[model samples]
Target: MILLRNLVFALFFGIGSVVIVGLAPVSALFGQRAMIRHATAWTRFHHQLVRWVLGIRVAVEGERPSGPALYAAKHQAMWETLELQMRLDGAAMVLKRELADIPVWGWAALRYGAIPVDREASAAALRQMIKDARRARAQGRSVLIFPEGTRVAPGETPPLKPGFAGLYGALDMPCVPVATDSGRCWPRKGLKRPGVITLRYGAAVPPGLPRRDAEALIHAGINALERRA
Candidate 1:
């Protein structure tokens, strides 16, 4: 039953995505942001469908970060990204610029304050990301950072990248560390795994002092999630 549902959704969204991407650029030229908004909302709706398809329930723990704190989280699965929109009243993600190349969804993300980073971590790329993030935060949006940069194998912890710590250092706002193991069921690629994913939101690290301190604290988050798995 789970496999069948996953397959159905995969087909439906996969095809629909093409249409949204194709139409988005033209819509943006006219400043018609509705399509992007629809795509964003649709993607979230799609995720809910995915949850039902796989019979996976997601539960978030602890308090959601308040104010413009840098939100650092584990990157074990893509589920964490989608779940944020529905879970938080206002949440933003620091994602790759390639996502912005997509049509409707990318346009909507820009409209909704999503920060896009460069693929190859370079000084210029990081600078652009920081600039974009700062702008978004100035507008009063919470930024979410997946410090590992890439998804690691289930139960494995990747080295915490300096970008997270650097961002933490540059921004004097509080930082929140969250942990999860959604990848055990949902492989990075292939059919979605069955059952609900459990997520634990750890406490916020008050912003002060220097950046190196963030590495230890962020690494602790990576370790904590691995322990949960």
Candidate 2:
């Protein structure tokens, strides 16, 4: 049954991506704001369609910080990627450079204003990321990133990567730590279970803290969710 649900969802996901991205140019003609709104609609559609089709409810706790803040979230599953956009009104996401290289999907992400970071080339990529992140901040959007760089299983806690701190210090924005248990249901691979996934946003970590201090604080904040789980 779970496999059947996932297969159906995958079908809709593919068709939806092609349709939305195909019509993206029409939105781009109006300008960046329109493009983001159009792209955001696609994300919201997926968020809703999942609940209606698969019965997976997304329960979000804590209010998202407004303005140009940095959101460092726990990477558990792909669900939070689009769900975060719905939560933050099409915020800019820091993703792998390869994702932006894909044909149609990549073009839409670039036009929609996602920050792509090259994980392999650490220094140069971080520099370019900060530059692009600042550009996104100037556009009045929040910066969303997974501090661990990749998704982890429910009980595993990985240290926050250097790029997260680099962006935190470089951008000099208030850092908001977020945690979620989407992996418990929608994992990185295999069957996805139908259940309510909780996304909890913790208090904001003030900017200008020492790297060690900020890392310690953010790690604790994100790990708190696992403790509760």
RMSD over all Cα atoms, model 2: 1.3
lDDT of 1 by residue, 1-229 (tens): 7668777877877776677656665555654245435446656766767666667787766776556678887877777787665555446688888987776567766766777888677898888788877876786767788898888777777687767866777767778788888887788877777776777777778887566676777678645757655
Task: Candidate 2: count the clashes.
Answer: 0
Q: lDDT of all the models against the reference? A: 0.72, 0.87
RMSD list, candidates in order: 2.9, 1.3
- What alpha-carbon RMSD in Å does predicted model 1 have with respect to the real structure? 2.9
Best by lDDT: 2
**Measured by TM-score, how close is model 1 to the native structure?**
0.84
lDDT of 2 by residue, 181-204 (tens): 888888787888899998888889
Show model 2 residue runs off by greater than 4 Å. Answer: none
- Which portions of model 1 show Cα errors greater than 4 Å? 15-40
User: Could you tell me every candidate's TM-score relative to the true structure?
Assistant: 0.84, 0.95
